[model samples]
Target chain A: MAELTTLREAIAGLVHDGDTVALEGFTHLIPTAAGHEIVRQGRRDLTLVRMTPDLVYDQLLGMGVARKLVFSWGGNPGVGSLHRFRDAVERGWPAPLEIEEHSHAGMANRYVAGASNLPFAVLRGYVGTDLASVTPTIRPITCPFTGEELMAVPALRPDVTVVHAQQADRAGNVALWGITGIQKEAVLAARRAIVTVEEVVDAFAPRPFQVVLPGIAIDAVAVVPRGAHPSYAHGYYDRDNAFYTAWDPISRDRDAYRAWMQRHVLDVDDFAGHLASLAAVA
Target chain B: MTAWDTDEVMTIVAARELRDGAVCFVGIGLPSEAANLARATHAPRCVLVYESGTIGAKPEVLPLSIGDGVLADHADAVVSVPEIFNYWLQAGRIDVGFLGAAQIDRHANINTTVVGSYAEPKVRLPGAGGAPEIAASAGEVVVVLRHTTRALVDRLDFVTSVGHGTGAGARDALGYPGRGPVAVITDLGVLRPDPATRELTLVAVHPGATADQARAATGWPLRVADDLAVTSSPTGEELAVLRDLRARTAASRGGPTRPVRPTGR
Candidate 1:
């Protein structure tokens, strides 16, 4: 039902140029390795999607991979602004970024609609707000049940959706716990879904509130340990706070960002190589 | 006893706004710190909900972000982002919405989207995540910000979250259910919306903070309440708990955690 492949193979074969890709992770279980792989392969003209679009998106944006960003919010987490994202939006240093903003509710409903094979999602959002002026997709619609008007946003069926989880069984059914986010909805909504996991086990032990993506739903599974490095994988490891703090400085300047990407992400053969480099440094 | 900074004072004032058993929709940074402090002290039963879908999270350490694994681990339940905003926030289950504003106008309209024009901004800020809905539907809103002349502006560059809009009936006419920004907590003083005008008026000044200083910091004509009371200094118990929380957070993160200070420039 699902093919077991390497991260590089998954990125190259499944992810293509000009495709709408969603790297869906709230703050936890961020698919940073897969994002790095996309950058390494040098995919361009891609519309990257996420709720927050944290450091991974920042990295991709800095590397000039994203042509557009469809997101609710983009930042450097507990720190401050995403400088590279700011540069692209403010000055168009690497490239000009076209933004389609939405509220978290609107974006989530978009994915839900996609997953449910619906044309659009309805919600009480963007009412009396300036967001409607900038985003054309957010439009008011009259309800059938009642005469009241509500907001509607089209379904977000991305070309590819990538996420990181704690474990996957050999059968390709992935299990992830703790702030699973909209990974399930994003994966089911995508034409292709790539899941990177910390480990592949014989069978999942079944934790409380675990989301198990059936093998048939997944296109590919890549066993990339510590896949969500700066972000955490719940039971596997704690979030690397030091790295998140360090990213602010590394990603602030154009030169520093490029050099860091060159050394860490682009220069590495794969995620393992990236890990080795970090280990070597430590 | 550890000496409290202005930020701590600001947090203490913000924490006092939360009522026991109230459902608070907490934004990250100062709001999170203040909400957590309230839960740890007076508002023990306060239900904390984060945008990351963690509901009733009780983190021993300050969360690095809303989606910090610790939040999920400590949460009573974790729902989807859509459910959080729609089912909880927009449905008006959240009694209090804690926010941090970059720029707040005289009418309490907040600007967290940009510093200049929408098309061409001098500084592009982190756009609204769930703040719009939270501000619209939460029973009340508490704004925690580092008070400065630049932050307290006459007009907002962009309205990321609508507080009172302009006057009393402004938010109601817009069809929002909740009472918009009830209080604005700053390092110098606390500003509450006038029932009639909906304008945020300086109602109380913190200890060692002068009313003139608070008035001087506001961009518009700051109205001092006729019956303005001095905000009581933070109790030693409150300070100790807050200090311990910060220490634990710093130890966990391998560095000291500090609240964000927004600069309009």
Candidate 2:
């Protein structure tokens, strides 16, 4: 059974230095609060993994919390570059970050393979692309029956997987809707899983396209309303697009990046405090 | 008629490529706008599949990102990311893969990865998201980007997605499923692959753009069709719908009326 806990406690209990951690949310339901907590707790050398390493990973990368990133794409979504990520890769500002890249299909399948407890997943991908040449995990395999050649990627089994959701029942069953992305596979693929939800509800009414992660699969359920903040939580709030655009300038300069992190993420006691600080500034 | 910029004409031309009821797997930025414009204008039944797993997404306003709540809220179905890639894309259920790239070569090969070396870089672009598989697996592919010497290069710094590989028979030899890039639409005009050589050739230029300008903009030894057609200007209705879409998107994002140009990934 999953324990109901605070975001800080969940991060402290689940994440560790040098762990392979996945904070999975495609473009919505991103675990921003959990990522912030990981930054606050001062974890180091984590192999931070996500399909799209959005603002949260940019923060973690800027703080030197990750020594490596295993992802498909690292960008500010509709915005341009994740400046901190670019800095880390280009100049090694905070650290010389190593990256193991894959295409979205490859990454998603890796998670699916991991969730299925399979050794590797096969797909008709990377046939003529440079990805197969660079990524060590991608290799060619021949189909025994049809004699067709395909690509195989090793399963991604993270040490901890963290996600943000809309609600968690009293029984710690997490229910999320609206672009659930790869959260379920990420959670199932990890040795430990943490879910930060907008609220703890009595029971799930079960919305369309809803995914419910039973308490048995989760390690902890943290109630942090609006945990996805800059990223939206479907019905809870809209995506803060201005903040995403605002991040560009703040992350471009090292000093501004540091100052922003110090003020918004590090100095705050928790996510609520972080929200309060932003509100005060606004 | 209302005046339309090159970017506007480029979007209109790209939107016109999609057939009614065609399933287009949309990349963010230009391709998204074009696909949405097609749905809003001529091809109302055109299905938009976003990488975020929103299949057949019909958004009222342009989405700031692929996984915006509007996409999911209006989608026919929302599947897991793995399923979207595996069951839909890799399974060849998609009819078209509409993409934009930082760099494209003579063969329509793309580079959204890096500017210099992979080991040590000048600029580290966002690596391949779904472009590789989309470029490989869709029935056909459509590329949309601004026409510049920097983008329409002789050779890519890195081949993030293979269009026709080296040239004709390359995709076939490599056993790629898709029919590579059928059209490379840009601000200047449209370049379709040469049926024999599979090299992208300038088939049409926009009204104000000349073949010489297109040639000057491309890094390679550009090829032009024998009877290169000058594209028609954007119709009033097309411009109105596109501008309205942009205005609504900008308003929702709390920005200026014009949608910002996407910086290369």
Candidate 3:
């Protein structure tokens, strides 16, 4: 397995053009910096999938890096700005995005099923509703054992999955101590996985049993402290409202957003410089 | 206090008696915040059911709405609205159905489907999602609404879900297994049913409210509970969190635009 040797080179190396990429984090618990880096670096036609996208999706969508997006829900908390998305829906953009609306369980279950290398997994979720409204790519067949009809959510084997972890070791094994059920499944379902950590540990054993993502599933680790800035790490930090508001996808002016991007992201290629610029602005 | 202050009181009044593990079929705004607070503090195991299929949602932040990823992303399991209603809720699982109202009557009846006549009337609401099924099948209903004479009318433009209509043991006679609409919680006070005629009776009042004030807000002969309790005001902590969530939610959609408030339908 090719290990991530350096932070700057790792992200650039792992992520490729025209690949289906699924990102980790949501809303305020965003993978802000790395996501901005990916977007500003101009990764194009890269199908981006987030459980429920917000600013990251908007920034990328607005910038035209993402060609297609598959998600359950889009738009920010209250004043969700899926306007670029709206315009894409109303007046087709780069490549009119395809929206797949369903519950989070249904969205992740497909990945879970894929990760386990199972033919299909039976779930009693979304049995009766408009969730069946979104025409799925796969069709269902009757279960012989119970005679109950089972839905077949297609396998989600993304080309690459980028996740933000709370901590990681030198050998690439990761540990995420926050709300995590989707992460385990996501890391496995993808062909390649990149784990960004808040700190790097050297053969350091985790004191808490719950803190781990065994070495086998992980391939590359990038140690970037305060990695989950906008995204809180369980009880570590409260949501940075100033940071969130600064990147307010719903209300931010185009020019201001462009400037924010230029100064914080485009102007710098590395995390340190990005942090420095962010500090300079702050 | 001001009218919005009254609304906040009404919101808390409904949340007062929440028990653990209740499958609260929630909508957005006040209901969502109340549901989350009840879960976070009072009822740890409170299974917050949403229309978007999230059940037992433990969101890090107060979800902006039912469809907020925080709802399902952190939920125990997500079920379809039909299954949420048909199997879990209507199949007799939900403990208490917490709901807000645009209008109420002395009979504890609610109107959310339409404002005027069914076919051609005044306003059209977001439409009946799972409210009909929930009202019909939940263990019991606990309604939260601001008490205004116009809101607490003698008659409804439409019967969204039969809470307690004009008769005694009517819902029981109709074969509703669950005890329906035990109380109507409002900014003014809490109202229960009179055992004899199933008419609504004032059961509790807020800190500053009086029985006469609650009576004035109703259009019919409002019955009185034997010993009514006064609902405490939102504490500083409660206000801080609720207000923070409210402010965030309000400012979320590009800072507040004029809200469409007519839902007597």
Candidate 4:
């Protein structure tokens, strides 16, 4: 059963140095607060896994918390490049970050394989692309029955998977709707999991197309309202598009990025404090 | 028709490529705009599948990202990411995989990965998201990118997705199920794969864009169709709808009326 806890306690108990951590959210319901808490706890050398390593991953990478990144795409969504990610990959500023890349299909399948407790996942991907040539994890496998060749990718089983959701019941069952990307797979695939929710309710209202993670699968549930800020929580609020565009300039320069992080992340007591700081600035 | 920009014509031309009821796996940015335009105008039944697991998404305004809340709110079904990739895309349910790239070669191969060496320095672009499989398994693929010598390159820094791999028999040799890129829509014009060589050839130039200009913009000695056609200008209705969409998207995102050029991938 999941123990209801605070975000700081959840991060301290669940995440560790050199752990393989996945903060799974596509665009909506991203665990920004959890990621911030992990940074605050000063974890180091984590092998961070995500499909699209957006602003949160960029922050973690900028802070030198990750030694490697296992992901598909790394960009600022509709805006531009994740400048801090580029700095780490290109110039090795702060640290030389290693990357193990794959296509979205490949990454998604890996998570599925992990969730299923399989060795590897097969797909019709990277056949004629250079991804297979560079990433040793992607290999060609011949079908035993059909005599057709396909690609095989090893399963991704993270040590800890963290996700943000709309709500959690008193029983600790987490439920989220609206673009629930790969959270379920990531949670099931990990050894332990933490879910940060907007609120802990008595019962779920049962929204359409909602995914509910049973308390049995989760290690802890943290209540942090507006936890997915910058990213949205479907009905709670809209995505902070202005902040995304604003990130480009701040992340472009190293000094600026560090100063911004020091003020918004390191100096803040918690996610609520971080939110207050942003509001104070705005 | 009223005055229109190059970007408008390119988007309109790309939108025209979609069949009325085709299932399009839409990439964000330009491809998303084009697919949405088709739905808003001609192809009302055109299904838009975003990789974010929102199948048949029908958003009122353009999504800033692939996994925007509006997409999920308006989607026919919201499956898991794994199901979207395996059961839908890899299963060959997608009819058209519309994509945009930073660099494309003569054979339509894409490079959204890097601008230089893989091991070392230069620009590190966003790695392949779903383009590899989309380029491989979709029934057919349509690519859109701004035409410049830098973008229409002879050699890619990295091959992120395979189009017509080396030449004619490439996909056949590799046992790929889907037909490779059928059309590459750009600001200058449209380039369709030559049936004989499987090389992208200039089939049509957009209005006000000359064949020489297209050739100059390409890095290689670009091939031209024997009877190269000059594409018709964007119709008034198309321009109006496109502008309206852009305006609404801008208002929602707190952005300028015209969006900045999208980054690689």
For each candidate, give its TM-score against the true structure. 0.97, 0.99, 0.63, 0.99
Return the lDDT, model 2, position B91: 92
Model 4 has an lDDT value of: 0.92
Q: What is candidate 4's CA lDDT for residue B260?
A: 46
lDDT of 3 by residue, A119-174 (tens): 56554333323234344643455788987665567777888887776667766677
Model 4 stretches astray by more than 4 angstroms:
B257-265
- Please give the distance, in angstroms, between residue B179's alpha carbon in candidate 1 and its true position after superposition: 1.3
Candidate by candidate, in order, the iRMS in Å equals 1.2, 1.2, 9.5, 1.1
Across B91-178, the per-residue lDDT of candidate 4 in tens digits comes to 9899999999989999999999998999884999988988888888899999988999999999998999999999999999988889
Instruction: Name the weakest run of 10 consecutive residues (lDDT summed) in model 4 chain A.
Output: A124-133
* Candidate scoring better on TM-score of 2 and 3: 2
Q: Which portions of model 3 show Cα errors greater than 4 Å? A: A26-29, A78-84, A90-95, A138-141, A203-211, A249-252, B1-6, B20-29, B36-265
Candidate 4 residue-wise lDDT at B158: 93
Model 3 Cα lDDT, one tens digit per residue, B163-239: 76556876764456567688877768888878787788887888889999988878776777778777777676555
Candidate 3 TM-score, true structure as reference = 0.63
Model 1, B93-183: lDDT tens per residue? 9998999888999888877788888888899888888787888888999989988888999888877778998788998877788888999
Model 2 agreement with the true structure over B1-265: per-residue lDDT tens digits:
5778999999999999999999999988898899999999999999999999999999999888879998998799999899899999989899999999999999999999998998888999988999999999999999999999999998898899999999989999999888989999999999999999999999999988999999999999999999999988899999999999998888888886333434322
Clashing pairs in 1: none
**Cα TM-score of candidate 4:** 0.99
What is residue A6's positional error in candidate 2, in angstroms? 1.0
